[model samples]
Target chain A: MIETTQLTKRYGNLTAVDGISFKVEPGQVLGFLGPNGAGKSTTMKMIAGFLAPTSGGAKVCGYDVESQPIEAKRSLGYLPEGAPSYGEMTPRAFLEFIADVRGIAGDARKRRLDDVIGRLQLEGVLAQPIDTLSKGFKRRVGLAQAILHDPPVLILDEPTDGLDPNQKHEVRALINAMSHDKIIVISTHILEEVHAVCTRAVIIAGGKLLADATPAELETRSRYHGAVSLTATNTGEARAALARVADIESIEIDPQDHRITAFPKKGRAIFVAVSDALKAQNVTVSELALEAGRLDEVFRTITQPQIKGGRA
Target chain B: MNPIATVFRRELKGYFATPVAYVFIVIFLILAGSLTFYFGGFYERGQADLSAFFIYHPWLYLFLVPAIAMRLWAEERKSGTIELLLTLPITMFQAVLAKFLAAWAFVGIALALTFPIWITVNYLGDPDNGVIFTGYVGSFLMAGAFLAIGSCLSAATRNQVVAFILTVVACFLLLLAGFPLVLGFFQTILPQGVVDAISGLSLYAHFDAISKGVLDLRDIVYFVLTIGAWLYATAIVIDLKKAD
Candidate 1:
């Protein structure tokens, strides 16, 4: 388990991380969602024992990070921001150094090294220096180093930030593969990533925790939840027909795509009602979708108020 | 393996991974050889000792040792590898000590490579090998003191050039504290006891004693304490400035 109680970090006058408390159990992947400079990295750094908190503390597997740093750190694997590593060393040599530092020795060390190398597909670049590797390869090497010993608690800061689409999918798959018994915490600004891998997500803005819930639960907060959107041939006729539906509280036309979206009243399902109404109006429907929710809209609604408040 | 040994091994190997180790060793050898022969007048002294060689060590190390130590923490901070290093299951003291020992051992290798000069001195005439050995010990100890200072200063900044310049200035002041020109100026203005106390803090005074064949216990303790105190400061500095 990884638990942080009222953790805070301050830099002179600026409070970078406010008093934030949360806990993660095994078999759960927690996504830390925040805007840029919202203290996501600082919180991760504190949890990993890389930065001392100004107030409160973190515990990994019941070991206090500040008082029992070695014990806590031994059970934790961290990939710091930017996936920093010794650039001069080859991936093979760098992994060996991390292995030695982690105290994985003898045949076990070799097995672990080979396992991670194969898992991350680093066999081809094992001999090349990390400095010469591409960003994606470097990120893989960083992930390889973190998982070499297979620590129970893994904290990655923006794990898929710089990856291409395929690499992002692979990394998300890797996270899923490892989420069976590990408490994995990954921080990212990408909203879709929360849906991609996170079992639970905590959104923060201006160094304050705004919301914490499962991705599905968080998505339900979106205004688009249970809403139906359709692209119709006769958009005006479709809008006129949908005006008569009692369940839909409002309707909007997307300026960019000319798709009409009808929002349902609280706790109402209008997919069937809207479909029937459109069919009766003889509307030519090209596409229709009952959105689970738009995570980006919910994210903006939850965090934008804080930004406006800060500016004012 | 223990974290210190692992980190030390990695740090030592890191120097060799680039052109740094080979270049540093080559430059150190060349400077040590020429300074002893051309500047120190080893031939004109006509003595069967390496006094000419040992005399120029402090001056040579002033520039070269800092070159080695400046990159110790500065490069880690620049490349953002300090976060990776510190987050590993290792104490700050272990990291600082391991890096220092690795750099010290690297300098030791460079110092040992001057064996041909020792052989040449022995070939010329019979010399006190014990004095030569003490001189080597003294030079190594002095190098450690310089390295410890450099390590602390390197932790204070992410820029290697700034670390290098600061370390050079700090080490130069320590060396100058024992110079006759500096001491003579203090003697006229200050009381004898104060002057003596000031000179006692000089690295030159302690190293000079050891290089002249007298391996005083006090001199050894001075170097050890200097290394210990500065390494302690290094850990503290890293803690305070690492997040910046």
Candidate 2:
């Protein structure tokens, strides 16, 4: 379990994380969302016992990160950004070093080492220096070290940042495989990751917590929620037909493509009624789609104000 | 195994993982051999004692020890491994002491390989082996001093070049404190007691006493305290500037 009570970090004049609080229970995979400098990394550092919080505190498995750092760290596994490891060491040696520090020894150490190496497909680069490997292999080496000891809480900062699509899917599957028993926190800007893998997410910007909810809840807050869009002859007749639907609140037509869109009143689903209206008016709808809403839209609505208002 | 032992073994092996260990050992042997033969007149003195060998250690270490110590923390910081290290279930002091011990032991290995000189001296004539042993101890202690300084300076920056330069300059000042050139400047403004105190802080004087065939408890304590103080400062520096 991991919990932060108003955790904050300040570097001289700039506040990187301002009094943010949340808890990650066992079996919960929380995706940390933010723009650049959103304090996601800072918060992860605090929980990992790498960076001291300027105020407030974090606890890992009930151990206070600042006061009981060793205990807190014993329960936590952290993969720093860029997956830094000893470049001179081969993947085998680096994992052995991490296993030693993590107190995995003898037969258990070998078993865990082989397990992660096999799972991450690190056998090809097992003897090669980490610096000589490609970026994806380097990331796998880091991931192997992180899960070598199998600690209770894992804080991965951008686990899939530089991975290709297939590698990203494999890593996501790995995280999903571990999510049933571990407390995993992943900080990322790739919003689709949250919808795909996160059980919950917290959006932070300008060092402040903007929203904390499940991916489903956040999607509902988008302006496109329950709205309908159709390309049924973007002509005036189609626009009037879309506007006359009972539950349809407004009709917006794209002048360039002549596509008609209908927004429901009070965020209700008006897809059936609008579809029926188009049929009754003899307007053949080519493409009719209803939105559960887009996470990108919600993310833009939550983060764009800071960019416009000039938070700096 | 203890975490310190774990860290120490990995780091010690890391020295050999690249060309660093071979280069350092080769350079050290060449310098120790050449300096003893040319400057100390090992052949001309016709003496079996290793004074010629031990005499130039402080100067050799003035350059070489920093080369070994500059990468102790600087490389970790530059590569971002320090974050993974400090976040492990180990204390700052443990990490600092482990790296220092690894470097010290590495230097010890280089020093031990100089045993051929001892064999050469003993084969030539009767020599005071007891004094020679003390000379090795003194050399190791002085290397520890230089290494401690290097370790502390290396923790202050991520750039290895900057760390190396700062360590050389800092150790140079410490060494110069006991020299007449610096003392002459200080004596103009300072009193006799302060001058004596500054002179008492000399690595030259303590290394001199041990190299001259006497093992003073005071010299041993000086090296111990110096290594301890600098290592403690290293721990504090890592804690303070590690995030940078």
Predicted candidate 1 versus true structure: per-residue lDDT over A115-141, tens digit per residue = 999999999999999999999999999
Predicted structure 1: lDDT: 0.94
What would the TM-scores of all predictions be? Answer: 0.98, 0.96
Poorest 10 consecutive residues by lDDT, candidate 2 chain A: A303-312
Model 2 lDDT tens row, B1-244: 7999999999999999988799999999999999999999998999889999998898899899999999999999999999989988999999999999999999999999999999999999999999999999999999999999999999999989899999988888788787888888889999988998998898777888888889999989999999999999998898899657
CAPRI-wise, candidate 2 is high
For residues A108-187, what per-residue lDDT tens digits would candidate 2 score against the true structure?
98899989999999989899998899998999898888888888899999999999999899999999999999999999
lDDT of every predicted structure (CA atoms): 0.94, 0.90
